[model samples]
Target: MNNFKFSENIESYLVSAKDIFISKIASGIKTRDELFTSLYNTLLLPGYFGFNWDALFDCLRDFHWIDEYLVIIVHEDLPTLSEEELRIYLHLLADACLDWKIDEEHKLEIVFPESVRCKVEHLLSAD
Candidate 1:
């Protein structure tokens, strides 16, 4: 999501899709896997937050573990998004982990693998 300067059409779609995922996470209407499904569905767009959430979840599920996250960040909007917005996006992901009762320490071990995790970390850290 770092290169969010996408075509207006792609950005527009993600703008709406972010809202959908945000609302679902907020209202307890969606689970971690459901959120990933919605995200994967929208990933056809270039500059979209394309992730291996499905593959990761499949691996975790075999161990009876689950993971959840949101690919959007306030930072994705660049100068348009405030630090507050970035925190909000991150906060939502944290809340989902809490809601699902994921143990923090284990989650650290389970989320994204090193190479992919570093990229995602850089994306989220973008100001």
Candidate 2:
């Protein structure tokens, strides 16, 4: 499992030779519903998706439908959710990363732009 943050040179990170599945969450996601919808569409989640945090974690940890060994989720911008929801989202990401590490079948990487890196780190570190 690799670190979540990409180096300052994202171009180099994007130059991987291995097969990878990349999903981009476009900006302007202000609500949990929008975030779920974007993830559902971008990741091509199964119809059984419940559109909730648990469902997201389940689907993210079980990317059996995706053939690529490396899965990269790039967030164009952070969502405008309540503190609790944001904390849950970040924990979900960290949990999924840990789950993938144990599974050893796929690698999950979450990338945030440099502009919001500090904010993201702060949120993740908050108790």
Candidate 3:
């Protein structure tokens, strides 16, 4: 949902990650594994935000598809959410991702609002 107007190249880059994600799911991969694998792989890569956000924006941005992964990170980083809340957040994120839509009604749950939600939701649902 980043309103910052990322370049089309950025969107295309994100789409690449999204393609991998869909393939993973279609192949019966676990959600956590898919997300973390993508994020961790991207984070370990070279550039800003630990790696260029545009180049891996699907896994990095504030979309429903990635909130569970961020929620897991939040437990490690925020030190506030209880084990149950973290679990709940993960479920919420999963539900949101499964039913994503570009319309105004689908408000993505942002545990931490670093980027836009709706725009990312749009990209996620576009597939």
Give me the candidate number with maximum TM-score.
Answer: 2
The runs of at least 3 residues in candidate 3 whose Cα sits more than 4 Å from the true structure, single-residue gaps closed, are 1-79, 102-127
Q: Which residue pairs in candidate 1 have backbone atoms (N, alpha carbon, C) closer than 3 angstroms, thus clashing?
A: none
Model 3 scores a C-alpha lDDT of 0.34
Off-target runs (Cα >4 Å) in candidate 2 are 6-18
Q: What is the lDDT for 75 in model 1?
A: 20
Q: Model 3, residue 124: what's the lDDT? A: 38
Over the stretch 1-127, how does candidate 3's per-residue lDDT look in tens digits?
2212223222332333322331111122234444444445433423333332233334333433332222221111111334444344344444544444555323332232224335334433543
TM-scores of the candidates are 0.24, 0.87, 0.22
What clash pairs does model 3 have? 1-116, 1-117, 1-120, 2-116
In order, candidate lDDTs are 0.33, 0.82, 0.34
| Model with the higher lDDT, candidate 1 or 3 | 3
Q: What TM-score quantifies how close candidate 3 is to the native fold? A: 0.22
What is the C-alpha lDDT profile of model 1 across 5-118, one tens digit per residue? 223232333344422222111112134444444434432222333344435333322322222233332222222224454344334444434443344322211122233344
- Tell me the tens digit of each residue's lDDT in model 2 across 35-125: 9999999899999999999999999988988888888888876788888998899889977887766457788988877777777778888
